[model samples]
Target: MDGPFATAFSLIASGDPALMQIIGLSLRVTLTAVLIACAVGLPLGAALALARFPGRGAVIVVFNALMGLPPVVAGLIVYLMLSRSGPLGSLALLFTPTAMIIAQTLLILPIVISLTRSVVEDLWAEYREQLLSLGAGRLRAVPTLLWDGRVSLLTGVLAGFGRASAEVGAVLIVGGNIAGHTRTMTTAITLETARGQLGLAVALGIILLTLTLTLNAVAWGAGQWARGRLG
Candidate 1:
């Protein structure tokens, strides 16, 4: 046990090429998924929170529920949808990086939407009275309100990215852990650990944790700076 642990530390210090590749791939997939989630989720969440419509509460409830969905369940759904004979099977995207990205996007979209809604909902409440008192049209008020709540909206994006980057189950199931192809840090770590390659696994694990930490720290600092500028 001690020997393998020591080897793991040593391998991590060596900075292996395979390790680098996995790390890079993980970042690419996570970033792509987060970007897609933001593009689709931000406006939808704002609409859900700000627009007056029938069944709006139900939509909010459904999104909130999906925000808590288990990763394995999401993975299974992706697997079925992309596997042979499945509805989307003709695309032939299973076991590919694109498939992993799609799965992760699905997993994180609900999170982004729910968090964005929460943030925007608060802003809507705070500004409703003031905007109405001034007789400002809802359309004119929306842009200003969204800008004022930029920090919170950014927080929601960060939350979604963080969640997507750290997720493993869905990515693993859909990506097949193919080396130099679909392999990501999370999948690599699992494969290495399963094969008793503890050294490589630990090294990858350390890198993964470090990357996640660095990204989140940068996001937090940026949010703080934005808040300061707003102030």
Candidate 2:
């Protein structure tokens, strides 16, 4: 507890194996989750923006509502589904990194969908007439709208990544925080702090903050570069 800063810095400088493993696992899980979310959400969002279906307004409202879904609740849903008595429990995905990734994917999917839908919808409004005049149907128009709004969509992806990386409750519940396996930075920090291992917790916290800041900075820079190129 005493001189936690010094201890944290020392641990980082020394490259403690356990700390490094936690950091690695956290990155792997969050990045995987974000990628999966983007893959599913981006196209779905574009479809929602371009298609004129009945009950569309209600559907958008539901997705927007889901954007604020609690992490623990999402975790609970996943836990039950993966539990032995649950429908999907036969595969035994509970308490694994795969389960953690699934939980995070669910948690961030709404963020990606909502943000992407908003951006694509706005872009579609401006480009709809020109696209129609050019003989472009809904399917062809989706790529054009998506490409034109790439910067904003990228920001949405970054936002999803931020949410996925910072979350603890869902991952902790599904991952079981097992050392050298599913232990991520957020879970490790919680466990260490609870066990009065302030130095280790501080070290993990510093690393997590650094990773988050660096990711945002890179995303901002990429957005700027894209804007410049597209401008």
Candidate 3:
């Protein structure tokens, strides 16, 4: 434990308030984005899974392709949308936490939607027989299928959180990485690295990884408990 590693440990042990504030803001933005994405994606994906309409395949393909959308591009799009000349410019959401959240939400929305679509679609096929036999329409089956497949769906949710938490490009552009305001863990790491504060950057990275790991573990455990209870 020397060099940056030593400094990182010291930083963690010191419980720096600035570090804690950054971590808290990061969680707030990422969690809020993930929640919003799930709220929209889960039901939409499930609907897509059950609904058979014209060009549905194309729509799915579009979403699947969007999963690979570059973060910088997402940030650029958000920036343009929120810029003073753009349609939503009147809201003045640019360079703010809300803007950061919007950017991250766009980044991870595809992941949640695509993954949920896949999981729900598979579950739908297997349950089609019983559900139809029970006179359950596609719309009616959505809730039941979602409930039974909740554990699997948690993977998509976690994936969204992971992506949102790790991405810096989108948030940086829309957030402006403003100190004590829109700055997040990812942006902070970028800032520290740019400032040549390697030790601080490494410490921030470790803290971020720990936070992500802890959240993932808790979510996984909760999913496991739900699965057990459902069984």
RMSD in order of candidates: 2.5, 1.3, 1.4
Write one digit per residue (lDDT tens) for candidate 3, span 144-221: 988888999999999989988999989999999999999899999999999998778887898889889999999999
Off by over 4 Å in 2: 1-3
Our tally of clashes for model 1 stands at 1
**lDDT ranking from best to worst?**
3, 2, 1
Q: Give a tens-digit lDDT track for model 1, residues 9-127.
A: 66667777776677788999999999999888877777777888988889999999998877778888999999988999999999999999999999889988898788878888989
Candidate 2: tens digits of C-alpha lDDT, residues 5-97: 677678788988988888888999999999999999998999999888899999999999998888889999999999989989998999888
Worst 10 residues of 2 by lDDT: 1-10
| After superposition, candidate 1 runs with Cα above 4 Å error | 1-15, 129-143
- Kindly report which residue pairs in candidate 2 clash with one another: none
Stretches > 4 Å off in candidate 3:
1-5
The TM-score, computed over Cα atoms with residue i paired to residue i, of candidate 1 is 0.89
How do all models score by TM-score? 0.89, 0.96, 0.95
